[model samples]
Structure formats: C-alpha cells, structure tokens
Target: MLPYACAWIAKSKGFGKPRREGGFDNHDPRAWLSRLTDWQARANAAQANSFEALPFFIGAVIIAHQLAAQQAVLDILALLFVTLRVIYIAMYVAGLPTVRSAIWALALLVNVGILFLGWR
Candidate 1:
C-alpha cells in the first residue's frame, strides 16, 4: 500500500497537468506513466514488484497460521519481512539494483521457509 501510494504521488507529481479537462483524458495513460523520472520511475517499479509479492506473502502467513506454526517463528519472520520490504523500497528508490534484488530474494526465501515450516 505504501509503495502504491508512493507511485501514485510520483505519477501525479511527474505529470503536472492533464491535456484534457474531463475525468478521462484523450492522452494515453501509458504516455503519462512513462514520463516519470529518477526516483519516481523507481517508485513505480517498486510498487509493481510489491504488488507481485503480495500474494505469496499473504498465502505464506495464512498457511502458517492455519498449520499452527510456531508463534515466535512466525512473529520473527513477519518482522523480518516487513523490515526487508522497507529496505527493499529504499534500495529500489536509491537505484541499488543488486542489493534490492538480493533483499527481494531473501524475502522470497523467508516466505517459502514459512510455508515449508508450517507444513512440517
């Protein structure tokens, strides 16, 4: 949600005015979206990635809870996921691709681990 909000703000800030007056503009939405620069672009990308990760994260938590996974472990993993996600957003905005990718992979692994541990 934070990422999405950031993207929305970036988009609005990047494209100052709509060419058309009505709610639906004649200009292509993609054109406006593509106009974002620097951190705004990165914020949009991060927002997309965050949306992509939501399903797996939600599923992992649901399965872990349903399977009676250790409460402490779940809590720790949840904290780690949130922390990593915050760092991930910062890395994305900062243009640190390598570090961002590494953090994304770690977060994915943590989600998988939660699922596996829950199943066990």
Candidate 2:
C-alpha cells in the first residue's frame, strides 16, 4: 500500500508537466519514470524501496506470529514501522537523504526487533 501510494504521488505530480518525451507515459511507465529528476523521481525511488522492503517486513511479522509473540508488542512495532515508513517517504521526497537514511536504519532495526519478539 505504501509503495502504491508512492507511485500514485509520483504519477499525480508528473501529470501536468513534461520533462522529456512527454509526461507520465503509461505505455512506457518505467522509462518515463526513469527520466524524472525531481520529487517525482524521489517518490519513484521510494516506491521501489518500499517494494523491496515488503517481503522482509511480511516475513518478520509472520515469523513473530508463528513464534507467538506478544500481541500488544507486535502491534506497536507494526504501527511504528508504518509511521517510520511514512516519515521515510516524506524525507525522501523532500530530498533529505541523510535523515532519510537514519530513518531507514531505524525502521530496519524495528523490523529486527519485531522478528525477535518471541525469542527465548
């Protein structure tokens, strides 16, 4: 959902502007996106990252559940993950790479913590 949100933002921002070879070419979306150099591009990059992060996050949650993690802790961590991701998206789109990287690291740590929630 976060990834899709990023894509939607990118597309919406791209709609009225042409950077090269026209704008938001649905026929060749990848190529069109690759040509972007603004916040739209950042959004696309963030979308890609969000997709990349999904499998790990899903796995972590599943592992936690399978291990019988405390429900409250798991839920809190999941909420924190979403919040951090939203901040990460904003930071990326705003071109704050340094802080964004920190947030990314923090989010990864949260995932790791979630993964170990039921560990003895």
Instruction: Give the range of the ten consecutive residues with the poorest summed lDDT in model 1.
Output: 17-26
After superposition, the stretches of candidate 1 with alpha carbons farther than 4 Å from their true spots are: 12-30
Angstrom error of the Cα, residue 44, model 1: value is 0.3
Clashing pairs in 1: none
**lDDT at 114 for candidate 1?**
76
Error of 1 at 110 (Å): 1.1
**Candidate with maximal lDDT:** 2
Provide the lDDT at 31 for model 2.
Answer: 88
Total clashing residue pairs per candidate?
0, 0
Residues 1-120, model 2: lDDT tens digits: 999999998888668667563767877889888877889889999999999999989999999999999999999999999899999999999999999999999999999999999897
Residue ranges of candidate 2 with Cα displaced over 4 Å: 16-21
Cα lDDT of candidate 1 equals 0.78
88: Cα error in model 1, Å: 0.7
